[model samples]
Target: MNNNPFCLPVFTDKWIKHFNTSGQEKRFDFIENVSFVKKSFLPVYINVGKNLTKGISYKFSNTGKDFKKKVFLLYDVPDYFELDTTHNFSSLKTIDIQQYPGYLVGTSQYPDITAFKKSRFGKSSLAKVNKYKRKLESSFDITYTLYYGDISRETYDLVFDKFKELLEKRFSEIHVHNNNLDPDEWEFYYDVIYDMILQKKASIYVIYDGDKPIAGSINYHFDKVAIGAIMAYDIDYSKFYLGFTIIHKLLEWAIDNGLEIFDFSKGKFGYKTQWSDQEYYFSYHILYDSSSLLANLLSSIMSLYFRLKVNLRERNIGMLKNKLLFFFKKKKKRATKDYKISEFDDTIDSQKFSKVSFDVKTLEYLKRITYDFLYSRSEHIRDIEIFQDLNDKKTFVILGKSAKQKVTFE
Candidate 1:
């Protein structure tokens, strides 16, 4: 009923059937109507006729014997798009159809409540969640002790060294195949993270097992949401599920501090889904020069093959009982020598941990005293010092140098 001439349906099943029904089939051509310009690496345009329901036409070159003598018919349309900014498509050859890439898309608009509810520790429904909450009347011992402090220079160095050691031990166990993340890269990344945390738009939570920090997570806060940016755990404690426990502790801290949402960030993995209730589609777009026709054709073919392979893998993952479809095989390698525990004793200068030289034993005693005092008076230390600017905001707790006095969110 619309009067717009551009609003015509050009490629329809009825028109195709009518074309095939005609006695003359060799070198047949038909015009298809389209409103938008065809986007392709090559320059192309669409022709729309006056008859709104009818088709429009386009031309193609017949260059060599290598080209098909006849047009091949297929059930599915080829996945090819013209090079317009809007990404419109029209006709594609059978060869072009085989070379499309498969991709994933992620967006923030998707609701993840259902996925969250299905997580390993998630309650099935609102009623069940309320029931569970009601049953727990007392607080339990959380695995990690969260602290915010202006760590001394020595302490910073010690922490960074420990992190490097932990990364070396844990990377292989975690099946991290990226050979690019070497010690130097990690050190550089850590330095950047540490600076950001000190600037107060971020906070680093170190999880200690006794006097040793075995796990840690860096969090960035924005309004009511906290994003767990980077996390690492000592490989020696892998059996204890230290990573999960650390995350659990972080979430508990968020809830206690009145934070509403925890963003896990991007990556498609079963563990992420365990704590997340949503998924988003992510896509990739590639632009290539039309002058390199052979290269483009070959690349397109390879892309299509990979797409099919990835699709099959995804389908298999969906059918499996455990969504994390990975296999690990143990291989013996030369174990790195472990440092003696006494080397970390408090008898050494605590300042040596950074570069200054204060008695390590004195440092240890001071920490214990600070911990005891903070533990007892944490409730009184309610107001947290938060810094914010147009670009970023962060929440933090400040612990005094010589006193047990601390500052934190109420």
Candidate 2:
């Protein structure tokens, strides 16, 4: 056991049972390490072997309400550490800390893989996926394989090398070359994946075209949750849509293994929403021991700094949005007139379809269908118009600089 008084030892089944006997839905708190800290010793023993003056600082994602309340019970002024960081704060009650937003893709929303593929949206998505599979198969022999529960070291090393090569090549295509990603840079992931593999707590899925790996995903499993950590596909097979194909296979595997949650971990990706049922944020908290005046003062100062940082970010939201737009290579100017989605009907002119604005509901719906289309890329898009056909049916027209496409709502 660790000698640090600030750390809590790993709990056994007895402790878990005691805490979960309330008959409520059980929640598993995700942690990167086993050394734990209670709020009581946070001020003095926080730095552990380092220095007491530095205090303790920890970051947690997907923190349970029970755990948050426990921290609140231990701290004197719990609100002091709470950071106002989330846009969806209204969903959660007034807690001692703010939750930083994060994304999760889980199997809880769907009963089974079959049911998941049976929805209208699911059917449409799968149809496109199948089409891609057929197109890819015409060129090479395709196979999807998963490594979990006793993967040999030889297999682990081989797959890890291939994943690295594929990732580097893919990034190179986008002009995002990372020359520093040598063996040393990858050692951390290699060690973590290897350990998890030995314990049968990780899954690595790879899609191959003949003997060559085309795409791969690394996932860690813990207490019924599978977290997807790394994913990369060969740029050569990108046109075949292998990236999406590999994740679909991983989800199918998760269902087969009875995993409850399939967390994408972190990021703001458009594709994640396709398989996600809900979204929540992640927050970092640092609680100082109240008895120590110096620790309390430092902690209070740090909290104020974080709060001000968030406020400054909010004021300059436009700059951040523009940066995101540029990263996606999208146009920055708006071209259409603003109109509430509900107000769109046959009375609207088709000429106005070149540029159109939507209400929140329509904007969200468009995002789901287009997969963050506007935010990612609006180049060559002359106009986006919505109107009703002669039969009073909703129709969307995408008028490009030299091309046109029409979408009819069912």
Candidate 3:
């Protein structure tokens, strides 16, 4: 236990119970050492926790050939993690079953965020992110707060609630389901995270517009590594490119606080790839006793299944499935357009659009257009005015200090 170099919080008993547990609680074991009995129903249940499992760093040892399970499979085992299963099994099969790339930023390597950004990203990319940050701050009372090791229960609840709301709204627009918001598991998150935060194992970085959380990220920390766990931004703020800004802020926090690695775990998203300096793969470690025919058969079958799945993902079948869902969901929800936005020149028309008193809550759909206008034009939120068309209920206009946008619906 003292010799274990890996301090991944994912392998902790609490994380395993909350994130990876199904009906197979009895099958999984860990800590001083780790082990998992394969699923009873299927020996080929290879993806036990494909996306969620960040793997462990321990080698299996020979226990005088008294293996209860024919085959042992470990997934998401990062290349950096030390593992030598040769002592345990003669027929060990290591497969590069990484479905998506894993990334990390060596925060300790750079003195500060600016230097880190300068070294990792080109000037244009850095400038673009900076522009978004500037625009966001210009439009609102922006506050960047980091809550680690201490936070009031009330503020924690409020931030998490808003985080879930933003996640739902963002994924809804793109027609996808976020597993984090699943009702069955969300309670675990709400309950577990607070104590974890107090224990210094968890963190929440929030970008606030006054008291409201517009963007946020929850990260897990162990030793020097900080895992970028969950992140969400209000879709209404999408035009400001809050994703880039949130990451930049998070990186800044991580570096300032002495986190060595910012593990952008298990994703090939454009942002992750762009920000990453060190690249590693999550692989499957299959150990089977050569004497056991059942073990060999099962491990081979499981390995083949993972290879096939990875191949399918490579061809972008996942995107195809999402597209299909988007089509079906759009039809099921509503084929009609909620609103349409276009550029227009301010002019006197017979319909006669007039400025109206409104708040952000009045027309949620208009928020994106308004933010986009702020991105392109030099105007603050206070200087902007919303207008309604006298003749058409479906038509409206948003007038900024120097720029205007036309909003219409059918």
Candidate 4:
């Protein structure tokens, strides 16, 4: 009976960081346990033992080892947003569809921000500050609906196919080359995701536009709280503002269903900030066996260096781009001179507005930032508060004071 606790597999360094930051720790003795995988390898799975309530155990696997980690770590954070129990949509009179033409504009048009402010529900009454702004448009006849269900074999296959298709199209558009997964591996990945979603009581919402699937989102419900997961929209209907419409519909559903928190997940994007009034701090952890000290130390040192470089580039380069855009706009305005200044200014403003008004470039930039920085960083281990002592063959558990208690172990 080899009594050595197996080192659980981790999918990414990000997951390792998440485990470290989650504030729970345990040591498993490896008496009857043996692991075929090494912690240093990519896609390391660490088995902690059996879960009592859910009858499900825990394992960690890293999907990417070399990719640069996104800065906005949503998966590392605790849920800080409280569910609003008083939200009611039926109380407000529904506006005629013919009155609001800009309702279904693309996400790049800042529809999410606009809708958040304009929405009659989910507004905080504590302060009189207005968050949403009004947009000029006629009414749209479309109404976004929310749909949720378990991932069956058919649905799972559909989602997996859609994800691959979307990933390939996006990669090609960006001119990036990456290896595609074989059918078996792809199915395995989907199975893992599907299992996790079920354990988390997750639901998928697909918003339709006249029977066509325009946008989709995955949401997880824990207790009375719902966390928004991966969301994407069809590129062809980018001008339809499907993302915002879907979000609004989901929020309404949350309120109606008595779900408390609607976590936007992790990121500090302009739109997320505009709608969300709260934020939770998050951190990352790095752990390794004491026997493998040298290897772990080297990996940690390299990871720290890479992270520092990334932070510097994001701050400095991002600032430089903003400054350059500001100067260009200033110069453009300064170069404009005419005898009829008011009339010329009006004409210029009209022309400039018309040229840029329907431009979804800004929306695309927001999506890119959110997807790269916020959404990508959210893939990590969850429900990892316990560990099995491999040395003693007994389950070592860590207890906390409160339901949302924060605990850390080395």
Candidate closest to the true structure, highest lDDT: 3
Q: lDDT of all predictions, in order shown?
A: 0.38, 0.49, 0.71, 0.36
Per TM-score, the best of the predicted structures is 3
TM-score leaderboard ranking: 3, 2, 4, 1
Cα lDDT tens digits for candidate 2, 202-274: 6788888667677888876656667676888865445567766776787777777787777675435666766
Which 10 residues in a row give candidate 2 its minimum summed lDDT?
46-55
| lDDT (Cα, tens digit) per residue for candidate 3, span 246-280 | 89998998898898888888768899988889888
Error of 4 at 62 (Å): 27
Per residue, candidate 4 scores C-alpha lDDT tens digits across 1-410 of 11111122322222233333442333223111212212433422232321001111112222222212211101121313221212122221111011100011122223344354454334462122221100101111233544344557675566656656554444344343323333443443444445545554566676543444446676655556566655666544333345555666676666556665576754355546545545553222223332344544544664475466447655665456544554553422211111110101111222222221112542232222222211122311121122223333221222112111111222
Model 3 misplacement above 4 A: 1-32, 35-38, 41-51, 61-69, 84-96, 185-188, 324-362, 401-410
- Runs of candidate 1 exceeding 4 Å displacement: 1-151, 174-180, 221-224, 285-410
User: Residue 407: error of model 3 in Å?
Assistant: 4.1
Which prediction has more favorable TM-score, 1 or 2?
2
Per-prediction RMSD in angstroms? 19.2, 17.1, 4.2, 24.5
Q: Estimate each model's TM-score.
A: 0.39, 0.53, 0.82, 0.42
Off by over 4 Å in 4: 1-37, 41-152, 163-189, 196-200, 287-303, 306-313, 316-410
**Model 2: residues >4 Å from true position, as ranges?**
1-33, 36-100, 118-126, 177-185, 305-410
lDDT by residue (1-410, candidate 1, tens digit) is 12111122222222222322332222222212222222234322212211112112222332222221222222111122121232222223323223212111121222343333334353454344433222211111223544343555576676667766666556554444322144444544455445444544456677665566767876654445555655767654333455655655565566556665565643455556655544433222222333446535644654576468557656664334221221232322323322111111122222322221112532222322223333333411122111112221111122322232321211
Model 1 TM-score (2 dp): 0.39
